[model samples]
Target: MKVIAFGASTSSSSINKALATYTANLIEGADVQVLDIANYNVPMFSEDTEKEIGQAEGAQAFLRDLSEADAFVISFAEHNGHYPAAYKNLFDWATRIDRSVFGEKPAVYLATSPGPGGAQTVLGAAVGSAPYFGGNVKASVSVPSFYENFDLDTGKVKNEEIASQLKEAVSALN
Candidate 1:
């Protein structure tokens, strides 16, 4: 199986990115592709911009990239308790290119932040939106108080209970 992983954030040092990378690697024997939304550089989506510039090559390429994966691992970063600008732009543009943005791929949705909310607000948004975008969310996990729950150097969950929860989620993917 092939898996594509990404954090829905563009920050240079994002906890979401770290969590997504770790989650992606946990799947056994699956080929994984990690994407940074910042690299795509898709401009903000608007009907006017869409009409003027047409489809961006980068956005089209991202759709192609999504099509290549059988599964997806996304860790969303909450910006003002919602989607980040870059990620929202990319998602909007990609959806316009193809309604089935996820291409019916199985997905593991994750979120993390320094605070205790664990980016739950955005994760909830994804849970509601994923199905409409052709995503089959096989699992969803939240890493709350990321700094306290995850070990930066070890790249693993610091708390055993959270680790067990994650293991269960990973098992559901298979």
Candidate 2:
């Protein structure tokens, strides 16, 4: 299976990206592609912006990536307890192009942050929104206290409890 993974953030050193990549690697023999939101620079969505930009090329590229994937792993980053603006903008644009941007693809929704709450609010938003976009959310996970539990340099979840939970959740993707 071809798995496409992404972190819903524009940060150059995004922990969500690192965590998502790590999780994607767990799926045995799957060809995984990791995407960076910064690579898709769709402008903020407004009716006027859409009218001016005509749905954006970046959004089409994002949709193309999803269309190529058999499954997905998305790690959301919380900004004000909500989805980050960059990802939201791209999703909005891609939805306008096609409501089923995810095309009923099996997906694992994940979230992580430095805080104990992880990025649960945004992950909740993803779980709720995925259905509308035809994304099959097989599992949803929140990795709390990312810094204390994940090591950026090694790209591993350091906490045993969290690691075990991740194994179960990610293993379900197989």
lDDT value for model 2: 0.89
CA lDDT of each candidate?
Answer: 0.88, 0.89
Candidate 2 lDDT by residue in tens digits, 1-174: 999998989999999999899988888899999999899877778999888879799999999888999999989999999988888888889999999998988888899999989988888888998888998999989999999999888899898888787777777777
TM-score of each: 0.96, 0.96
lDDT: worst 10-residue window of model 1: 165-174
Clashes of each: 0, 0
As a whole number from 0 to 100, the lDDT of residue 133 in candidate 2 is: 91
Stretches > 4 Å off in candidate 2: none
Candidate 1 global CA lDDT score: 0.88
Regions of model 1 farther than 4 Å from truth: none
Tell me the RMSD of model 1 versus the true structure.
1.0
Model 2: lowest-lDDT 10 consecutive positions: 165-174
